[model samples]
Target: METLSLLADGFSVALTPSNLFLAVVGCILGTVIGALPGLGPSNGVAILIPLAFSLGLDATAALVLMTAVYYGAMYGGRISSILLNIPGDEPALMTTLDGYPMAKAGRASDALVLSGVASFVGAFLATIGLILLAPMLARIAFLFGPAEYFALYLLAFSTLGGIASNNQAKAAIAACIGLGISMIGLDNNTGIARLTMGELHLMDGVDFLVAIVGLFAVTEVFVFIESHGKNSALGVKLGKITIPVKDILRCKWTMLRSTFIGFIAGVLPGAGASLGSFMAYSAEKSLVRDNSQFGKGDVRGVAAPEAGNNAAAGGALVPMLTLGVPGSGTTAVLLALLMTLNITPGPTLFTDRPDVVWGLIASLLIANVVLLLLNVPMVRLFVHILSVPPWVLLPGVTMISFVGIFSLSGSTFDLLLMIGFGAMGFFLRKLDVPTVPIILGILLGNNMEDSLRRAMVISGGEWTYLFSSGIAIGLWVAAVLGFVAPMFLRGKIRKPQAITD
Candidate 1:
C-alpha cells in the first residue's frame, strides 16, 4: 500500500509536462546513439550529461531523461547488429550472429520487429522484478555492517573481474590500474596529495564523468576514424514490422528462461549484460534439439540473447539502487551521475527519497512502452540515424562531453584529462582488455577501502573479523570461485585459439 502511494506520487512528478517532453526527446536521442556503432549507453549518457546541466534541469528530471535514453539505446542497438553485422556494444554481439544472417536471408523487417518485441518483453518483465524485489532487497541491506560491506565489495570486484573479462590476469591488471587512478588527488585521511605528480590540478581527483566520456566516447571516436571510408553499409530494406504469432509461441519459453537468467546474472556483482546474453545463448543452444541452426539465422537464437541482455540491463539497476554499488560499466556511470546530483543511493535512499526511487522506476515502465511504440512504427527513422558521418557525429559528441564537464567546474585541466584518458581508452580496447572493470574499480575502490578500514577498527584490527560471519565467508568463497573458474575456462579455450591464430 505504501509502495503504491509512492508510485502514485512519482507519476505525479514524472508526468509533468516538461518531464514528459524530456523523456520523449531522450528516448529518441538514445536510440540514435545506440544505432550508431561504438556509441553504447555508457557513452551516450556520458556525452549528454552536459546537455542536462546546461538546460538547468533538476536531478530527478535529468535522471529520468538519462534512464530513458539508457533503455532506448538498448532497443536501438539491435538494428545495426541485425542489418550491418556490427554490434553497438559487447552485449549486442550475440544478436549479430543470428540477426545479421536473418537480415541477409531477406527477413530484416521481421528480425527488427521480433527483436523489438523481445526487448520490450524482457525489459517490462525485468522492471516487474525490480519493483517487487528492490524494496525487499533494500530492507535486507540494512542488516549489513561495515565488515559485511567490505566483504560484499570484495565479492563484487572479484566477480566482476571473473565474469566480465575473459582473461583474469588482464582483468586484475586493469582493476589495479583503476584503483591506482582512484587513489590520486588529496588523501581523505591524511589530507595530503599522493599521486598528483606535482600538477596543481591533481589536487582534486579526476572527475568520474570526464573519465567516462573520455574512455568511452573519445576512444570510440579514434576507433571510428580508423574505420573511416570503409564500406559499413545498411544493405537491406526494411520491408514490414510484423511478428508472426507462431514465432512468439515457439520462443515463449526461451524468453521466460532468459528473463530469469538475466535478472539473476544482473543481481550478482561483476556479472554484466554480455555474460547474461552469452549464457542465455549457450543455454538455448543446449535446450533446443536443432541447435545446429543457431548461427544460421535461427529465430530462437535471436530472441534468447535479446531478451537476456535487456533484462540484464534492468537487473544491473538492482545493486546500484539498493546497495549503492554498481553491477556494470553503465551503472557505474549512472552512479557518478547520482553522486553529482547529491543523491546518495543505498538502503536509506528508498526511505529518504521515495520520490526519486519510485519516480525513476515508474519512468522506466513508461520508457519501455515509449521505446516499443517508437521502434515499431519509426524503424526507418532509427536506421537512418546510421547514415550520419563519423566526422560530424564524433565532433558533436566531443563538444557535448567538453561542455558538460566545463559546466560542472569550468576547469581547463578537466578537458586535458579527458583527452589523455581517451587516448588511454583507445589503447586499452586495442589490447582486448575490458574497460568495464576499470570503471567499476574507480567507482567502488574508495568505498571498499573505507569499509575495510571501518571493519578493522570495529574488530580492533583483528583479521579474523573478515571471516566472522557465515554470510561473509560464503561471499568470500563465491568470490574465489568466480575468479578461478574463468581462468580454468580460458586455459581450455586458449589451445584452440593458438591453432586459429
Candidate 2:
C-alpha cells in the first residue's frame, strides 16, 4: 500500500509537463551521445551539469533530465553496437558479439528490435526492483550509527577496487589520493588546513564538479586524442525494425533471467553495467551449453546483454540513492550532482526528499518508454552520430565541460583546477588506476571522517569503539574479506579491465 502510494506521488510529480518535456529531450540527446564512439552516459551527464545549471533548473528538474539521459544511453548503446562493430558504450560491448554478426547476416533489423525490446524489459523490471528494494535498504540504513556507517564505508571502500575493474591496489591508490585531496579544507577541531599547500583557494577543498568533469569528460577527450581516434562505425543496411514472435518467445526466459542477474550485479559494490551485461551474456552462453550461437548471432546473446545492462542501470541507482555509494561511473557522476544540489543521499533521502527519489524512479520508468519509442523510429538518425567528425565533436565537448565548470565557480581558478585534474586523470588512467574510486573517495571521505570522529567522541575517544558493535564487526570482517580475498584469488578472478578500451 505504501509503495503504491509513493508510486502515485512519483507519477504525479514526474508527469508534470515540464518534467515530461525534459525527459524526452534527455532521451534523444542520450541516444545520440551514446551512439558516439567514446561518449557514454557518464560523459553526457557530466558535460550537462553546467548546462543544466546555466539553465538554472531546480535540483529535481536538473537531475531528472540527467537521469533520463542515463537511462536513454543504455538503450542507445545497442544502436551502434548492433549496426557497427563499435560498441556505443561500455555495457554495449557484449552486444557486438552477436549483434554485428546478425547485421552481417541481414538480420540487423531483428537485432536492433530485439535488443531494444530486451533493454526496455530489463530497465522496466529493474525500476520495479528499485521501487521495492531501495525502501528496505534505506530503512535498514536508518538504524546505522556512526560506527556502523564507518564500517559500511570501509566495506564500500574495500570492494570498490573490484568494481568495474579488478585492480584493488590501483583503486586503493586512487582512493587515497581522493582522501588526501578531500582533506584540503579546514579541519573541524582546528581551523588549520590539511593539504591547502598555502593557497587560499585550497581552503575550500577540491570541487566535486571540477573533479568529475576533468576525470570523466576532459580525460576522455585527451585519451581520444592520444589515440588519434577516427570514426570507426561502418554503415549497416536496414529496412524495417521488426522481431519474429518466435524469437521473442525464445528469449522470454533469457530476458527474465538476465534482468535479475543484472539487477543483483548492479546492487553489488563496484560491479556496474559492463560487468552485469558481460556476466549475463556469459551465463546465457554457459547455460545454453553446446548449442549456443553466442559468438555468431545468437538472439539470446543480444537479448541478454541489452536486458542486463539496462537492468543494471536501475540496480546501480540503489546504493547511490540509499547509501551514498555509487556502483558505476554514471552513478558516481549522479552522486556528485546530488551532493552539488546539497542533498545527502543516505536514508534521509527518502523521508527528506521523497520528491527527488520518487520522481527520479518515476522518470526512469518513463525514460525507458521514451527510449523504446525513440530507438526504433530514430535508429537511422542515431547512426549519424557515428559520422560526426572528431574535430567538431571534441571541441564541442570541451566547450561544454569548460562552460559547466566556469558557470559553477564564475572564475578561471576552477577551470585551471579542472585542466590539472584532467591531466592527472589522463596519467592515472594511463597507469591503470581507476579514477572513479578516487571520485568516490573524495565524495565519501568527508562523511567517513566525520562518522569516525563522531564514533570516537561518543566513546570518549576509545579505540575499541569502532569494533564495539556486532554490526560494525560484521562490516569490518566483510571489508577485510573484500580487500583480502582478491589477493588469494588473484589468478582466479579476472584481471582488471575497463568496460571500454
Candidate 3:
C-alpha cells in the first residue's frame, strides 16, 4: 500500500504537461537515433546530455527524457538489424542473425511485429521485476560498510574485465587507460594537479560527454567515411503488423524462458543485454531438437534474443537504482547523469527521492506501450531511412556531433580532444579491444579508489580489513573467479587451434 501511494505521487510528477512532452520527444528522437547505423543508446544519450542541460531540465525531467530514449532505442535497434543486417549495438547483434534472414525471406513485416511484441513482453515483465526487487535490494545495501563497498567495486571492475572483451589483456589495458584519463583533472581531496599537462581545459579532466561522443559516435563516422559511397539495397517491404494466434502459442514457452534468462542476466552486475541474448539463444538451441534450423530464419530464434535483450535492459536498472552500481555501458552513462544531478544513488535514494525513482518507473511502463504503438504502422518510415546513402549521411552525422559537442562546452580544445579520442577509438577497434570497459573504468574508477582509501583509513592502514568481514571475503572470492573464468574459457576455445598448428 505504501508502494502504491508512492507510485501515485510519482505519477503526479511524471504526468505534468512539460515532463510528458519531454518523454514523448525523447522517445521519438531516440527511435530515430537507434534506426541510424553506428549509433546506440549510450551514444544517443551522450550526444543529447548537453541539450538536456541547455534546456534547464531538473533531475527528474532529465532522467525521464534519457530513460525514454534508452527504451526507444531498444525498440528502434531492431529495425536496422532486421532490414539492413546491421546491428545498432552489441545486444542487437543476436537479433540480426534471425531477423535479417526473416527479412530476406520476405517476412520483414512479420519479423518486425514479432520482435516488437516480444520486446514489449520482455521489457514489461522486467519492469515488474525492477519495482518488486529494487527496494528490497536497496535494504540489503544499507548494511554495507566501507570494506564491503571496496570489495564490491573490485568485483565490478573485475567482472567488467571478464565480460567486456574476449581478450583479457586488451580489456585490462583499456581499463587502465580509462582510469588514467579520468585522473587527469585536479584532485578533489588534495587539490593537487595530477595530469593536467599544463592545459587549462585538462583542469576539469575529460568531460564524460566528450569521451562518449568521441569514442562511439565520432569514431563511427571515420569508419563510415572509409566506406562512404557504399550502400546496402534492401527490398523488404513492411506490411500489416499482426501475429497469428497459432504462432504465439508455438513460441509461448520460448518467450517465458527467454524473459527469465534476460531478467536474471540483467540483475547480475557487469552482465548486459548481449550476454542475456546469447545465453537465451544457447539455451533455446540446446532445448530444441532440430537445432539445424535454429539460425536460418527461425521465428523462435528471433523471439528468444529480442525478448532476452529487452528484459536484460530492464534488469540492468535493478543494480543501478538499488546498489548505485550500473550493469551495462548505457546504465553507466545514466549513472553519470545522476551524479551530475547531485543525486547520490544508494539505499537512501528510495526514501529521499521516491518521486524521482517511482516516476521514472511509471514512465517506463507508459513508454513501453507508446513504443509498441509507434512501431506498428510507423516501421516503414524507419525502413525508408536505410535508403539514404552513406556518403550523404556520414557528413551530416559528423557535423551534428561536432556542433553538439561545441555547443555543450564551447571549447575549441575539447573539439580537438574529441577528434584525438576518435582516432584512438578507431585504433582500439582495429585491435579488437572493447570500448565499453574503458567507459566503465572511467565511470567507476574514482569511486572505487575512494572506497578503497576510506576502508584503509578506517582500518588504520591494516590490509586485512579488506578481508575481515565475511561479505568482503566472499566478494573478493567472486572477483577472483570473475577474472579467471574468462581466461579458462578462452583457453579451451584456443586449444584446437594450437593442436592443429
Tens digit per residue, CA lDDT, model 2, 1-501: 998888889989899999999999999998888888778888778888777877988988888899998998888888878787888788888898889899889998888888888999999999999999999999998888999999888887787775445678888898899887888888866677877779888888888888888888888789879877664554546777665678878999999999999999898767788878987887888888564577889999899999999999999999889988888888988888888787889999999999988998998889888998888756767766777766678778988899888988897889999999999999997898888788888888888899999999999999799999888899999888878787777665553243342
Candidate 1, poorest ten consecutive residues by summed lDDT:
492-501
The list of candidate 2 runs beyond 4 A from truth reads 234-236, 490-492, 495-501
In model 2, the Cα lDDT at residue 26 comes to 92
Q: What pairs collide in candidate 2?
A: 163-270
What's model 1's overall lDDT? 0.82
Per-residue lDDT over 1-501 for candidate 3, one digit per residue giving the tens place of the 0 to 100 score: 877887788888888988888788878877777777777888777777767776778999999899999888887888888887887666787888888888888888888888888888888899888988998999989888888988887777677778655777787888788777888888866888888879887988888777877887788887776766544534546766666556556778888899899999888878878787777777887898777877788888888888898899999999898878888888887887887677888888998999899999988887888788777667777777666666666677678778878887899988998898889999998888878777877777777777888889999999999899888899899988887887878743221110100
Q: Each prediction's Cα RMSD?
A: 2.6, 1.9, 3.2
TM-score winner between candidates 2 and 3: 2
Reference-based TM-score of each model = 0.94, 0.96, 0.94
Per-residue lDDT tens digits of candidate 1, residues 217-333?
888778878778253553447776676677778888898888888878777877767767777777888998889999899999888888988998899899999998888887888
What TM-score should be assigned to candidate 1? 0.94
Please report the candidate that would top lDDT against the real structure: 2
Q: What is the lDDT of residue 73 in candidate 2?
A: 86
